[model samples]
Each structure stands twice: as C-alpha cells, then as structure tokens.
Target: MNKQPQGNIFHTPEMFRVFDQTKGHKSTLWAVVDNDNCPLALLLPVHVTLMNGLLRQLTTRAIAYGSILSVPGTAGQTALALLLQTYKREAKGTALFTELRNLSDLGQPQTLLNDNGFAYEGHLNYLINLNRPAEELLQSIGQRTRKKIRKGLRDGFVQMSEATTLAELEHWYEILQKTYSNAQVPLADRSLFMAAFNELYPKGMAKFLLAQVNGVTAACSIELPYKNVIYGWYGGSDRAYSDYLPNEMLIWHILEWGANNGYGIYDFGGAGKPDEEYGVRDFKAKFGGDLVNFGRNVYVHNPSLLKLSKRGYEVYRRFFIR
Candidate 1:
C-alpha cells in the first residue's frame, strides 16, 4: 500500500495496528490479489462504535480513512469492484454505514463506487505547501493570523512542545474531551490515542504536541506524519486561554516546524461538507492553504437504522459524552 502514490497514513500497517488496539475500533483489511499473490487493490476500514451495548449497535459505522488504494489503470478498477462486492456481502448487519473518506482524486473509481452503491458527497480540505522558507511560509498565512501568531509568541507566555509521557497524553486528552464535549460531538475513545502513542509514536508516524500558557497546558494537537505530508488529526484548546491565542500559535509552530524539517505538505485532515457552515473550515482557511474538494463516498448498509442512529447520537451526546 505504501508503494501506491495515493496511499495515506491511515491505510498503512501502523494505523491498522493502532486501530486494532484501540477500544471501540475494529479494523479490517481487504485486498484483491493475483494468482502469484501480488496485491492489486487494498482497503483498511475501521469499524467505529461509540457507546455500549444497544447504543453501540446504533453508532457503529465503518470509515475508510484514505479511501481505497489501487494500482493505476483499469485493472485496479476491476479489483476494487470485486473487493467492494465481497465486502458489502459480508458487511451486512455489521454497521449502519460504510464511508470512504477520500484524500485524493479517484477518477475512474468514483464511477465504480457509485455503481457499487457508494453515494458521493462533496467535502473540503486544506493542503498547505511546506517546501519553502520559513519566512515565506509565515508570509503566506492570512494577515490577521500572522499578526496573532506574532503577538502570541511575543507575549512570551506561550510555549509548545511534543508530548512524551503518559501524563502528558492524558492532559492533552483532557483538553480534547472538554472541547468535543462542549461542541456536543462524539470523540473517539481515549484508548485510540494511547494506542497511537504506543505504535505510531515510536516509529515517528504520530506526533502528540502540547501548547502551554504560563506552564499550564492550554492546547493540544495530534498529527500523523507519513512520507512527505503531515496529517492534522485531532486538536483542541482550553477556551479559558483563548485570549492567548494558543491554538493559532500552536498551528503556526507546526507549520514552521514542518517547513524546516523537510516535510512537503501539511494536510488539514478535513474541512466539512462544502454546503455546510463549519467554523473549523473557516479557521483552517485563514492558514492560507489550497482548498481541495476530495469529497467522500458512503454506502448505507441499513438505511432505516441510519435515521434512528442519528437521533440516538443526539441523545448519546446529552447523556453519555459529558
């Protein structure tokens, strides 16, 4: 999979290991291989369940983080179709839906996916080029963002560092929990981060970072760095420190760090659907990256249950997430 140019970190063995070890996450690998056993197409879809018992059934959904990885041309398309058919047959009663979160243009496979019952939706993402001088990169940021970053650094109260210990990871997760809770969005189990720290961190595939204000951690971001790109995974900030702009400072620090460290691009993991009013997308836009509509495709295995699952999720957020 790594040999495929479009293959992403989420499709790699490291991520598969992390997901397999994480609570509420079950990853499955599917591939189409030739007679000689050479792989033609591959996919790693992680089945995510958010709650316990019955609620778990409602929340269960499979996400293919980087979509399908296939060798170039018609042969790859044929393999993908066969794999999709096999997965669909076996995936019944397992989840409400299966979504492919695409990272690149799937020219021919897009039609293949549609024919196979995967409906496409427009999604957006930001990709910032980092193959330039730090000064150039700084100047590329929005005027206001640049000013805030400069002022935040000038204050001398904000500091950034890579998280190393379990205590530090816990602290970072606390900030993320508060942020997600307040937003009423269900976050992945903490075990996911713990697993990433164990499997991906040691190999330099994952980076956990902390931003501090007056020695107290105020913001945190977890990134997956693979090949020449750094994929922003999860992040949050303590609103109490909003005045310090710790989030902005922390992001700029990563951009600058990436520029100097030889990385080629910084991927804002995802913006939201193009038609939606997502504040996160607006915030990422100010970072001066090229917006790309990689979009996503989803196949609903249980349409009736999907509707119920949506309502159930709201209830779950109210009673369980906090």
Candidate 2:
C-alpha cells in the first residue's frame, strides 16, 4: 500500500519509479512510519503479479522474492509489527505461489511471513563477498571450469558494460525465450522487464553487462545495484560464449567493477537447489559464493488453510507447469 509520494529519504533507489506509480494489477510494498507516523521505506514486492483482488482469482498460494519491509533504523521492527497487525485484521484470500525474494534478514522475514500465514517453499541464492583479489578469486574455480575460463580469454571475448543497448535487451529477450522454451519453464512477462529496464537504466541503480567478440554480443548479464551491493539479477549467452568462457570473463569484469565501486557483495543470486541445479551450484561456488537457505524458517498462521488448498495447486501444477 502507498500513499501519495512525500519524498521519503529511506526509499531505496533500486525500486523502479513505475512501481512508485502502482500500475501493475496486483503488487505489495513496504511502508515506513515514524513516531508521528512519518513514512519510510515503501519498496516493491519481490514478486510481481496481476491478480483480480476479488477471490475470483484467489484460489492458491505462491512464493515471492524481494519483498522488503524496511524502516530507516528502528522501524524494521515496527514495520513487521504493522504487517502482522494488518494480516491478522485483513480478510482471507487465496493466491498461487506468492514468493518473497531478496530478503537479507531471512530470520525476521521468515518469522513475520509465517506468522502472517505464508509458507516458504525455499530461498534460492548464493552470495559472494567481493572482498578478495580477482586473481585469488579466479583460482577457486573447478579445474575444468578454470581451463574453460582461460580458453574463453584465448577466444577473443571481451567484457564490457553499457554496450548492452536496447538491441541487446531485445536480443536477450529472444535468448531468454529460447532458454525457457528449451527448458520448458515459464517465460517472465516481457513488458514487466521492459518497464523495469526503462525505469532503472544508466543513471539510477541498475547496471548491464555485455560480453562481446568481433563486435558481436556473446554473453550478457544485468545487475541491480543497491546499498553498495550488486545483485546478479538476470543473464543469458549464445552457445559460443560458453565455449569461450565469456560468461566467466563477464562476471570477472562485473566483480572488478563492484569492488572499485565500493560494493561488498556480489549476489550471484539463486540457483534453486543443489539437487535440481548442480551445474549452477557448482558454477557459482567457483566464484567463492556460499549457499544460504534463504527462506526456510517460516511461521504459518493458518496451517489448515494451506493444507486444504494443496490439492488445487497439485492438480494445477500437474496440468499446466508439468
């Protein structure tokens, strides 16, 4: 929920201005208050959706990310207390996979979310503190992967940022489509990303990376810069880049930039689970990332409601996602 913008200082630049306008179908955000009810952090939800608000669409639950309820210094506790108060007082509804991503305070959020009746399917992420030398960091990769990194350098790949133009984002859209199509996973909404990129490009708190060779785009990634930490949010690469190790080099450049820019952590982001994404897990670990079970400690308010609705989701997943 948002009131008219009053130019609060605690607002995170990472949140897009479009989110400030509240144009999407269904979105949740954090709000801060002072002793006199002053507003603080009203951030974008970790999850994005278009729900009917009316229970007409209220038939399931979902996991969400990036749902941050922050209040300058002491209001974090106040914000959580407010969330519990509102959740306890609100009417019941249904949802499908309301995920809360980018929660740094995993313990507090899991407690608040569980108390509010949300279940954490899991938290997916690996964070690498970019506090070490680049060469020292590079040495940590698996032998074969390390060799691949060296080969990538030999193949004439170059790493650069802001080379990622509108054309590249569109190309990435195509690459991502191909990736999802090949993997049979759902593609994220394109307009949502377009809006996101348009809002956060260049000046604000966003950065894009491009791996190029002979002036051709090979691998690319995007990072969300906030509070001196850059999140390795999204990326894709052509098959050739994998052979050349441009992906590794792209990250190498990114990490270098982060270090110089005063950033402390390079969140390689989530890799699902080790069992499901062993390759990804191994790949990120090569960069000195550590696994963090991000969203496991939850407190559920209505266990019966969640249990009762599982069958609907079971059938829906089998029919649609499966």
Cα TM-score per model: 0.97, 0.73
lDDT of 1 by residue, 1-322 (tens): 6578898898888899899998889999999998999888887889998776867778899999989888888889889999999999998998899999999888888999999999999999999999999989999999999988888878888999988999988988999998999888888889999999999999999889899999998999998889999999999999999989888988998899899999999999999999989999999999999999989999999999999989977777788776
For each candidate, the alpha-carbon lDDT, in order, equals 0.91, 0.57
Total colliding residue pairs, candidate 2: 24
Candidate with maximal lDDT? 1
lDDT tens digits by residue: candidate 2, 128-204: 77776766656765677667776766665575656346776776667656655555454556664575577666555
Q: What does the lDDT come to for candidate 2?
A: 0.57
